[model samples]
Target: MELLLVEDDERVSRFVRRGLEAEGYSVTAAQDGVAGLSRARAESYDVLILDVMLPGLSGRDVCRQLRKAEVSTPILMLTALDHTDDKVECLRGGADDYLTKPFDFEELLARLEALARRGRGFSSEPPAVLEVGNVRIDRQSMRVLLDGEPVELTAKEYQLLDLLLSSPGRVFSRTRILNKVWGYDSDPLTNVVDVYIRRLRGKMRWDRDTGWIRTIRSYGYRLDPTI
Candidate 1:
């Protein structure tokens, strides 16, 4: 797989590049945001490893521009900013995943593999239809099936469901959800996420007797595993 590694730290860049290359991925390294964004727009890559800080333009900006340009390449953001706000910002900015500094290489590789699999529209295990009770999620077509029937969802709803179903049983805070489904630096007070989640639940549970999206009171929400 072709991978783009955008980082300014020379030592960290070299270390990660060698590790990924050793694992059989063709690695391209860019030391600054401008060069990284240029390479990203110029070529097709399977995944991007972007550092939050760069010489010109932030990684967040690069991610936003890539998404704006409709590049579907999976992005994994790397940074020393471990604050929840920072992580949320990156996700909202268009990153698929976030990793703090001093991370384990093994975990990073695993996350990259997962992102690759998702990008290729394949899961590691057998391809079984995903169902949350009566609601079915068609991974192949990015469509929702309810009661064996198709249910229409807006773009935002689809994205919200995708995020929740991708990591079921994991409680995602409002901030994190905002980043993942919206974009980084979105208005934190906006009820857009809640509205979309309610809409999704309304459609998904229309024919079912139970709810799939469970609210965690003040924390956030999560997909109930038992559903």
Candidate 2:
């Protein structure tokens, strides 16, 4: 995932950038709130980590401005303040989450993952590669392969596959899939899902022993890793 970190604290920013990069994320960092806000407005990122205290502008103001500009990216505020009021203020200013200084890196990572997944039906964290059975998907390159053989897919097909692979076995209802993947709710007259499912199965060469996309009768579909 592409992330923008807005922090004036050099030590903190470097720490986060290094950690996230090691975990396969593309990170761009800004040192001050104004610069950070400018970058956020001019570019698209999967997530933003903003420090509460910064030169020129406060993280709260940056978040508020981003929201005003209709930028829906998730914002995680980093603050040394630990009061309940501080947390409330961050949320009130349109921040999605906040981390107290001296916080556990693991916890911060978890929160980042959670915030990043808010609108997308992806794995909690941004993943470079996803694997199920012999099927492998390289998220960075948007390539799919089965047992080392490349598989070509249409744009929509690839998106559907990516959603399923995001969380194996997380049963996604037809309506949910329709909204998430198709960008709309399900319609009784539409058989688009069936058509895509059939296409996916055929393209993936699914068989009884390798049926990764399992139909949960009367409900929806799930990626069965066991299959």
Candidate 3:
């Protein structure tokens, strides 16, 4: 599933993005309402998660504008406001659903799944296979193949590779990678991400100079853009 998350809180964004990714949802995030609105307009997603309190424009305003523009994507609003009036206001402004602050991750997941179902009339899923260059993964089987040959990968390695494959050529910072592949609660100083990257590279037979996985010095990694 592809999701647009509009949130200004780094901690909250990191938390939700990681949790959803771990469950195999692809996420694109915007830190403020302006960027969020732009992304919503320019791209397509299975669902959108917008925080009520945002910089530049509020989530309600964003929702209203999207409706006015006929975007029609299912929207689930997030707000610290728990009152009936607040919930009603969100629905009135065109939100499909509403979640109160400090929500249970499970509840959020359920709500997202519900919205997806409501939109598609059934459960939506990621693509059956994701391929970039010679590497590909079967979303259902969680199996990877390189050049028609099966390759073995640990769970974490598979996740790291999946992340890289999801956005070919897009640079992912070490911190973002760590938070996505690992949990947001992981130790920030750990070298675990580097270790996993090396493991994935070796198993995939990554070429140091021209492999799909390229390391950005002092930054992080990305799949080869030209591939």
Candidate 4:
């Protein structure tokens, strides 16, 4: 999932951006309201976390203008103040959810996920790591672990694992894997898939007992957690 955070406070923006990125969600940030609004307009994001207090445009105005402009991406307003009217105004202005400053990170993630799910009917899972058998992938930190120990992998290897781990059990054919991981499909004769699979198996220490990656004859590969 892609997210845009429009916050002015450098400390807060850095903290939230780092935290969100670690959770596996692609995140882009803008320091102030004008820049935030422009970015949100120019690109597509699954969710937008906007601070109520901003430099050029207020978060409320941004929300109103977004709705006015027909941008329906979910907006979760952040504020230091927790007033009754503040909550009312946030919703009234077209924001989807609200979170106060100094709030719990876990709670923030939960609300953000919920709002995103409501918007797109997709997983809102963040801060929580994705697990497959003994392999754990943290989307936020882009960290991968095997059996509680850190396992080093190349960027492409991690992306491939992330793709497989994101949707377990479903077979990802070589062509699909190539298109997704490499962002383009080469000639059908490439042996890239087999090579990466070997590297992943070697690094992950897969075996008949582990049975992490399953070869479906001539079809493709799937992550079989049952192993």
Model 4 pairs whose backbones collide: 21-140, 22-139, 22-140, 22-141, 23-139, 23-140, 24-139, 24-140
lDDT of 1 by residue, 1-227 (tens): 89999999999999999877655579999999999999999999999999999989889999999999999999999999889999988889889999999897767877998999989988688444566666677777877876778888888888788778766776767766777677653475788777887888787763223567788777578787554
TM per candidate comes to: 0.56, 0.57, 0.60, 0.58
Candidate 2: segments with Cα more than 4 A from true spot: 121-227
> Across residues 153-201, which tens digit of lDDT does each residue of candidate 4 receive?
9999998989888778767777667777987654578889889988988
* Total clashing pairs in model 3: 0
Q: Judge candidate 3 against the unseen true structure and give its global Cα lDDT, from 0 to 1.
A: 0.87
Candidate 2 per-residue lDDT over residues 53-168, each given as its tens digit: 99999999999999999999999999989999999989998988888998876577668778778846665556788887888999889899988999999988998999888778
Q: Which one wins by lDDT: 1 or 3?
A: 3
**What is the full ranking by TM-score, best candidate first?**
3, 4, 2, 1
Kindly list the per-residue Cα lDDT of model 3 for residues 39-158, writing each as its tens digit: 999999999999999999999999999999999999999988999999999999999999998997767977998898887776366678998777779978999998889999888998
In model 1, which range of ten residues has the least summed lDDT? 203-212
Instruction: Identify the runs in model 3 with alpha carbons over 4 angstroms from their true place.
Output: 1-78, 97-123, 225-227
List all candidate RMSDs to the true structure. Answer: 13.8, 14.2, 6.7, 13.6
**What is the lDDT of every predicted structure here?**
0.83, 0.85, 0.87, 0.86
